[model samples]
Target: MKTTIEKFAGDTEGVSYELTVFRFKGTSKTAPSAYIQAALHAGELPGVVAIHALMPKLRAAEAEGRILGDITIVPAANPVGRAQYVFGELEGRFHLGTRTNFNRDFPLLDRPDKAALPPPPRNATVDVHLKRLLVGLSVGHDIVLDLHCDDEGVPYLYVPAQLWPAMQDCAAAMGVEAVILWDGESGAAFEEAAIHPWLQLPAEKAPLEGRVVTTVEFRGLADVYDRYARTDAEGIYRLLATRGVIGDAKAARPRKFSGVAAPIDRVELISMPRAGAILFHVEPGRSVRKGARLATIVHTPGEPDGSIDILAPQAGYVLTRVSKRSGRAGDDIIKLIGEARSARPKAGALED
Candidate 1:
């Protein structure tokens, strides 16, 4: 086991952030290597605690000489977002300085090599530097897991459409409730950037089945509990063992994934029609019929038509909702996994 602290200079003089990386050596030279990172959004901590719980298991495996492949972990991936707090609330999703998502704008390498990455510009912000540093550390690996969490949702995975059926085993091993498959581009998100380089190579040189890449949403943001962390840790360990990154004779065989598997276009981003306090009639993991009342917005308080009802656009499964009760007009208030392609299919990533 080894630890490295990488420092990146901040936009101002004498300001900097440290990114800690951990590495574990393997006994077999032919085994596939893996990379796991958590909290890229900074405030999302489900993956952070899960990684904390998973370390002891990896240490034990190393001690027992059961670790067969290289493993690298970054329990907290974003030191820049980790320090961003506005007024009293934690602002961790987008970089405050550049207003760019910490997970977006990653360098899409031409090939799966560090040399293929372009040099950062002299005027690049700290966020850009951080993205490049993360890509450099992960692109060379065979498996990459960028751990994150949604606002208020069940455990799920955002897998590239190219890696769907092959990555289902990983999804099943992680015990997530849903799997969303996306194709083309996702604003050059980390998952898209990680797989972009490999797809450039021929199938013989880079068999798609041998690689694993995903942005794991470990349930909602507030689900950072010991029980959930332990469960998620075990799920990840199961994947490592199943993928032959580590040897675990007693690990159970993964069953077929039975969760909702849908394309990115099938998702419905139900936005609020009017800005006001919301009263949700449905939560995540629930089923709804078309035209069912999903929520009500108190737009004009103390009036006859003071509120407006938000109904389900179609029969579907509720995937997530905004954590806040209040929202503005046109803000996405909830997400629904419709039975078919959405009436208004969306492109790119799910959110900005």
Candidate 2:
């Protein structure tokens, strides 16, 4: 087990932030390697805890010489977001200075030429530097897992369309409740940026068989607990074993996963019509019929007949909901995973 700290120049003078990486070296150079990161959105702590639980097992494997390939773990991927706080509220999703999402607009390198790359600004923000450093570390790995969590939701995965059935084992190992496949350039997210170059290469020349990348959402914010973390960690270990990164003790175990996988566009975002207090009628992972009452908004709390009901537009599973009880008009209150629904925008970005 080896630890390395990568320092990135901060936005302000004399300030800096560091990313800690844990590496477990393997014997074979051609063996599959993996990069796992947690808390890119610092407020999402479930992945952080889960990674903590995963480390001990990895250490045990290291001692037993069961590790077949290199493994890298970044327990906390965003120091900037982790430190962001205003008036007692943690603002970790987007940069406060630039109002840009921390996960969006990452640098994409399709070729090895430096001339083809866009010139950096004379004074880039801290977020840009952070993105560059993070992407640089993950670019060559055979497998990349960016662990995150939704505002409030069940365990789900965001995968690229090209990696579908191949990633089913990973999804099954994680025990994810849902998988959403997307393709093309959406918003230059980290996963896309890291995997795009290889995907762009000619099929005959590219080593497509060795690459696997996906973003794992480890349920909701409030779902952070020891039991969940341990379960998630064990699932990740099983995934590693199944992938041949570790020995095949847990890998030989039968699959117990029972989740639905669908295209990203098929997952509908049910938004609120008016601002009000929300009362949810359904929980995450629950099945719902089309036109079933999903939630109710008290738009005018003191007035008679002040409530408005939000119904499911299609028959599917309730994958997630907004974390806050109060929301404004047009706010996405619920997310449904339905079959054969009209596709949303095909751009590769995730819904915020």
Candidate 3:
């Protein structure tokens, strides 16, 4: 296994973004290759552990000559977001000045205009150019696994529906039963852009023909040295083996909630509209009826405090809730999973 760090774009007096590569060579060109990246949002640390554990296995596979194809691992993919800090707290999710989510704004090529290309020839200009860049770096193989984790909860995989069965086989090897399908509506998430959206394009537009490209999401913020982290790492290695990049995957015991799942149809981000002290009336994961008491917001500045009771606007399952006691206006208090409904102009405002 040979590791090299190359500067792709930004590197200045104080800022640098380097692409870290771990290459493991296979004897035949027929073998499949794998790519893995982590820490796009630096605060999500499980993926960092997942990639770190994958490295030693890659090295072992290389030494044993068990490698079936080339493998590339990038443990830290975003240096800019990873280095951001605010008031001693690591603020790695957004760009400091712009406040833009670093994971958003992925670039994509426009579909070719019919006039530009005749029937016999397809418009492969844009994606071809884009693929040329990624392929040139790892010219020998096929497959890319962009790993990630949420801020607070369970593990899941975002597999593009187009690449089903093939990628499904790959996912199943990790005993991953649930997949959060990216049906083209999860706006601008890096994995959605790189893996799922590419799968949606027509054959002429897609760059990968038969390769498996998908992402794995481990459970949310928790102990780095916890058993869950170790379990997640092992699952990744098993996935590598099933892809023919390594030897047999270690046996793993599936968790309680191990199974395929669909992404929530709607995300009702409940937040307070006024500065107040929060008091919860319901726990997370509870199904609440419309108009039921959900929580209470109180203005507790003086001895005699005034409070406003908050109620659920619709029936839904509470996916998450804020634990903080105090909240400012517009701070997210909870996120409810709800039934599909038409888009409203001020949809989010209703929740707040």
Candidate 4:
């Protein structure tokens, strides 16, 4: 239950981020050491609520010496984003001035050559820097959970496909109903950029060699500071318990969703040819057929109202749709998902 506040290098507003660590003082090391970070995207708030609710229980676990190894939790991980707003509307999703999503751009560092280290006595900030230091800190852990929430949609699990069935089982144990196995290349995402090098086998190897990492989406945006977010917190707590970070066996166990990994084959993003006010005809997590009427744009007078129909593309499940009713041209529509369909679009189709 100890906490430390450190100022990030680029922070100018005097806002400090707290990093809390919980562990039993006198206990044997546990199998899984983990980290939890929330509020990376300020507008997406559920993770904040989830962490607050889980903290008291974590403290109790620490007092009872049930906590095994280190578990770090950073609830308000992005103070800058949290503070960004305009006329009561959240401007936190994108950078205020540049309009860029902060979560999309983190620094990437490649592995350093063994011979490159000058006896570990580098005096320069560039050599012994925060990026290198954080990388070193993360390499020792079993798992890193980056807590996130969608702007509007059902909760889903996002893990590097490299982790496979173990991660799938873990997600189900945490009560995550839908899991998306993402194989696309990630850029500058906080969780991915921080640990991707360690997960790689070599320069361009297919298999990862180190610990498993995942970014979990709990639900939609705007509920982070509230009580309902506890669902995700409890789910993560169960996951930690199952991994042996906490001593309670009952807390560690949970019911499984049959064929947890099989449904992952169905997740797909249906893009719009042109975007306008997104009229959603189908809600999230529903089953839809191919060529079903998904949404109809409200046509303005004197203009051809472009009608958008979301075909399930393949017969499968629907996970989530665009949260905001209004959309600019070229935005993505609901992500129509179904199990493992070869008809899924290739990478180039998604590229601009």
Query: Where in model 3 is the C-alpha error above 4 Å?
Result: 8-17, 109-142, 164-178, 185-187, 196-212, 249-260, 263-267, 279-325, 338-352
Residue-level lDDT for 325 in candidate 4:
81
Alpha carbon lDDT of each predicted model? 0.93, 0.84, 0.59, 0.61
lDDT of candidate 4 over 249-279, digit per residue (tens): 8887655655334334355677665655667
TM-score of each: 0.98, 0.94, 0.70, 0.79
Off by over 4 Å in 1: none
Tell how far residue 173 is off in model 2, in angstroms: 1.1
For lDDT, candidate 3 versus 4, the one ahead is 4
Per-residue lDDT of candidate 1, residues 179-204 (tens digit): 99999999999999999999999989
Backbone clashes under 3 angstroms, per model: 0, 2, 4, 5
Model 3 per-residue lDDT tens digits across residues 241-345: 766666554432222333544443455567786788988887655778877887888876554657777777677666556547789988877755554431321
Q: Give the Cα error of residue 299 in candidate 1, in Å.
A: 1.0
On a 0 to 1 TM-score scale, where does candidate 3 land against the true structure? 0.70
Error of 2 at 127 (Å): 0.5
| Top candidate when judged by TM-score against the true structure | 1
lDDT for 68 in candidate 3 is 74
Deviation (Å) of 82 in candidate 1: 0.9
